[model samples]
Target chain A: MGVRVQEGDFDLAVELADFGRGAGGIVTFTGVARNNDAGNLQYMEIEHYPAMTQSAIEAIANEARSRWDLCDLLIIHRHGRLAPGARIMMVATASAHRADAFAAAEFLMDYLKSRAPFWKKEVTSDSAEWVAAKEADEKALDRW
Target chain B: MIDVVYFAWVRERIGLPRESVETDATTVAELIDELSKREERYALAFSDRGAIRAAVDQTLVDLDAPLKGAREVAFFPPMTGG
Candidate 1:
């Protein structure tokens, strides 16, 4: 298990391959930046309460582990300013079977999106706005 | 004693991000009540109690859950994490 909050990008393919180890399956989910109708988003500034963020993430990871027979997992979420098209976060899971791997990866992502402490401030061409919690995000958690 | 933290709009309403308080409460609800009585700012910050979510020692916890042995408690809006 690993949680990274940084400005650098990640290589999901390499991450998945490494996580696979001797496992039979690996599933990875990558969340990318998207252009919103609000305008051209120059960048997104992410803020998080350090201790709380880590604890929340670890709790999610623990839940994932308990639900799946996984070999390893990786969660990398970036903080600070990020331009459009940049990677926002990635979750990868490896397991002895495809079903467990797939479900676990999705579960981790869903929980991370809804439960983590990080918040985003979108910097549009005209002005900056704090991204509110989307209803869809809360709904995503119900799938688990 | 616990270190309670507020973030984003919660902090904006409460007027501070961090504070230390000693309490005899065992659950988050009691703590919230105590905090809401502190000042108008806290009252406004905790006005819509349902809109706020909490974490004990950084783990997401139900408001009615016991806070025994917790070192930190945090209140904020529903997470918008990615």
Candidate 2:
């Protein structure tokens, strides 16, 4: 029902407080910034296509809603620098059936991983580099 | 003239966020070709077509995608969002 691309962090508790009413099942997935090994990781910078990011996510959320009888759905992605352990983004789906909720959640995640316009640049003590997109993530869509 | 924007490493390589281009290019491919001939940065950023993704206006489109009447174009690396 909502899609947000922002610089600020989101509180799951606050986000879910008024979420998914009257649903038999709800599934939530949160992506956190994890330190790359060699652990000198300082912070990660996220860049996004400002004009396309929100619409792209909303389109995916709509697709998820269509594929499942979702009561509600939400996608929130954070931009800007984030420290290790900071919550980066989250997706939540609600449906009358557990299977529907679960399936849609996975669908959204799979598509979001590769299709959205955000990019991650990892910063360590010595250097920073744009995270190379993974082929596996693109292949994950074939299963759908 | 079309507003051409760059993002991610493409922006870093090109050293600017966007530019205005007046062109007769009819497709994204033609536009890239035009830009590639502009300077080393443009050429380097666009040397490999496989590494670049583009959008017309704000919608993602293929390089062969038409640019007729489009006011904006954007280029960047393949999306790594999640």
Candidate 3:
């Protein structure tokens, strides 16, 4: 159960090959890069705080474990340039019950969305812009 | 000297990703003020305080957060990570 910040894509099957030996349920979430509304996306450039990223993710992962009863967890996020349809990140949670696994996965998602030290910028054929954080994303944390 | 880093649009507007600054400021707000006075670029990047977020020594904090003993400070817009 850990966090990894990388520049390369991850293989889910290989990552879970030896995962969750005795857990009753395991849940996983994968985020994919999508094209702009005009369907002219070139690629996305992800910028991250190199010095703080891993530790920041680990802190949130630890918070998830503290809040939920889980057997294991895995969070992997990628940086750098990524093409559309490429995987951006993945989260997996294992627990003795399905509820814990599902809840933990959601919690990790909510926390990482606004709290993590990473940013995404969308580039199209003629222009590029940073993806603004939605107000709802910040408000989502209030539910916890 | 404290290492100040910028990300995303802040990096773009400031025209640099990172720099080291010798400062006597005691808080993040003061640091921003110092940087803003240096050039119009810095002023433009920091024009909207509400849209910016700061981290001192890798931990997120409010603008009033003390800069004492901090070796690094990062400024960026709200994170949009998944």
- Highest DockQ: give the candidate number: 3
lDDT of 3 by residue, A1-144 (tens): 979999999999999987787999999999999988899999999889989999999999999999998999999999999999999999999999999999999999998999999899999989889999999999999998
TM-score of 3: 0.98
Q: Chain B of candidate 2 versus the native chain B: what TM-score?
A: 0.97
TM-score of chain B of 1: 0.96
Check candidate 1 and list the clashing pairs.
Answer: none
Best by TM-score: 3
True contacts kept of each: 0.82, 0.84, 0.90
Local accuracy of candidate 2 as per-residue lDDT tens digits, B8-71: 9999999999889999999999999999999999999999899899989888899999999999
Tens-place lDDT per residue, model 1, B5-61, is 988788878888899999988899999999999899999989998788998887888
Q: How would you encode candidate 2's per-residue C-alpha lDDT over A83-134 as one tens digit per residue?
A: 9999999999998999999999999999888888888999988899999888
Judged by whole-model lDDT over C-alpha atoms, candidate 3 comes out at 0.95
Q: Distance (Å) between predicted and true CA of A32, model 3?
A: 0.2
* Model 1 stretches astray by more than 4 angstroms: B22-26
Interface RMSD of 3: 0.5
| Deviation in Å, model 1, residue B82 alpha carbon | 2.2
- Which residues of candidate 3, in runs, are more than 4 Å off? none
